[model samples]
Target: MELCFFDQVKAQPLWVQILLVVGTISILKFSFAVLNWVYVTFLRPGKNLKKYGSWALVTGPTDGIGKSFAFQLARKGLNLVLVGRNPDKLKEVSDGIQAKFGKVQIKSVVVDFSGDLTEGIRKIEEAIEGLDIGVLINNVGISYPYARFFHEVDEQLLKNLIQINVEGTTKVTQAVLPGMVKRKKGAIVNIGSGAAIVIPSDPLYAVYAATKAYIDQFSRCLYVEYKKSGIDVQCQVPLYVATKMASIKRSSFLVPSTDGYARAAMRWIGYEPRCTPYWPHSLLWALVHMLPEYAVDAWRLQFCLAVRKKGQLKDSRKKE
Candidate 1:
């Protein structure tokens, strides 16, 4: 009996190993399906807004996705209130807007949402007073300092990301939501990533991606809860765009341009709960989503988990 047990353990056949792998994949697929079902149908309601009004507050307006939103929205003739850390950069963007659109009511606030997030949000609330703010873009966000696993991220930096990504976002959303709800009209578009679609094995921006995933989830819930009240909350999940945020996975095919996402976002602004940029990006996200569960998860793990060897985040050292 001992000999038989040893033989079975030692020889667990090739087919058996394959079966085990396939079975695990099957289980993960089912779980993923359930998650989609919950988020799509039961978890959050789809809210739609026909009129988002005129005044729009766009956070993170100094760079990347935020900048794209600012430029595009300005072109669409929306008054812009820029929220970001760098006042100089914000002014630069503001200047560019004025140059092109001939003065689009551009305003900038030099506030870092992560630093004393509540205070920053309060200041924003005060700054935009007397305006019926209809559109709120929670765009300021970041990810870096990948020295260790989730537990190993610098406490201060990690806290800042949480504050900006989750807490600050919540505060801004809650503050703006009342105005929309009272007016019975508003639009809130939260940016998310492909990493949220599948759990990444990549460790580099695990928390960043997770926070994005949370935004995705939270937006869905908000959309559902506020749809009837004429408030539209959309979770815009695009793949990795070529931004400073995902500096690690800089690939030609993998990275979409900031302008590309901005255009796609414009289309979805009128829609709700869009996993969008649907024509081209949707094609890619679909391929990734269709992949067997374990394979997708493993791909993420392999890409993200190997990030520890990379150095920590650093401010730009170029002499400005």
Candidate 2:
């Protein structure tokens, strides 16, 4: 059999022999990648979160992904420190979680990311003092309300994008890092976006995409810096979830609800430094990368333009 295999390869033309070898290697690599993804996404058991600590702190916990994460963490029996801008909304979420997870302790911290972050971060530090906060979820972020040209972005809108998305995440992580470092056991999950990682560009939403790019790099660096310290840092990049931020009101197979996304996210913590937790989002990420960058850029630009046109029309009607 070995002799026959050698003879068959020797009999083939040079190009055919090269093609056969290349094809075999490609197939093996692809198969291995698929198996790895399947194991990580489904078969692998998640780390026992309580081992990191007894409490989890989540920013922007009043609504959307942050809110969903707060509830999920509570379900895991981890006490929660819920931070958000709105006191009333924070109370509402705290009450809701308390009603269901009666044994879980919940503390509410009001931090307006777009406002004075020094004070906001101080509040966070004060709230977590002397508590064993093992998990920190930097989920508070904002994006363009509607796609617009970079030049069309107003001064205030631009400021808020940088403030809330980039600066806010950075400061919150800073406030929590010392505690985790002292304990030498923690997990920090920063919510990122596909605009920065999966796609080549985000077209008109330039500032939002740029801020998320910062998050991706920040998480990667922290992951490397703290790996030996027994702290896990990750940046989770999701495509679109049915959230108010995305203006996606309904969930579909491709677009998970906030709850569904958070559940998937929980399984991925303390693992990869960067990931797309939702399985469908991973599929989309693969597809997007398979295409040429220019093709994806053109498609994204067109899509954003349509969204902007619709938003403009709605604004005009409201004014009239």
Best candidate (score: lDDT): 2
| Position 272, candidate 2: lDDT | 97
lDDT of 2 by residue, 1-320 (tens): 99999999999999999999999999999999999999999998988999999999999898899999999999999999999999999999999999999999999988889898999999999999999999999999888889999999999999999999899999899999999999999999999999889999999999999999999999999999999999999999999999999999999999999999999999999999999999999999999889999999999999999999998998899999
TM-score for candidate 2, residues paired by index: 0.97
Report the CA-based lDDT of candidate 1 relative to the real structure.
0.74
How does model 2 fare in lDDT?
A: 0.95
Off by over 4 Å in 2: 10-18
Sequence-dependent TM-score of model 1 = 0.77
Local distance difference test, per candidate? Answer: 0.74, 0.95
* Per-residue accuracy of model 1 over 1-320 as CA lDDT, tens digit each: 99996677568888887787799899999899768745643345332322577778898998888898888888777788888898899999999988999857877877888677677878787877776677788887777754357767778888887888888788888777877888888889887767665344345567777788889899999988998897878887776688877663353555667876686577667356645653456557657767787887676666555655444323233333
Candidate of highest TM-score: 2
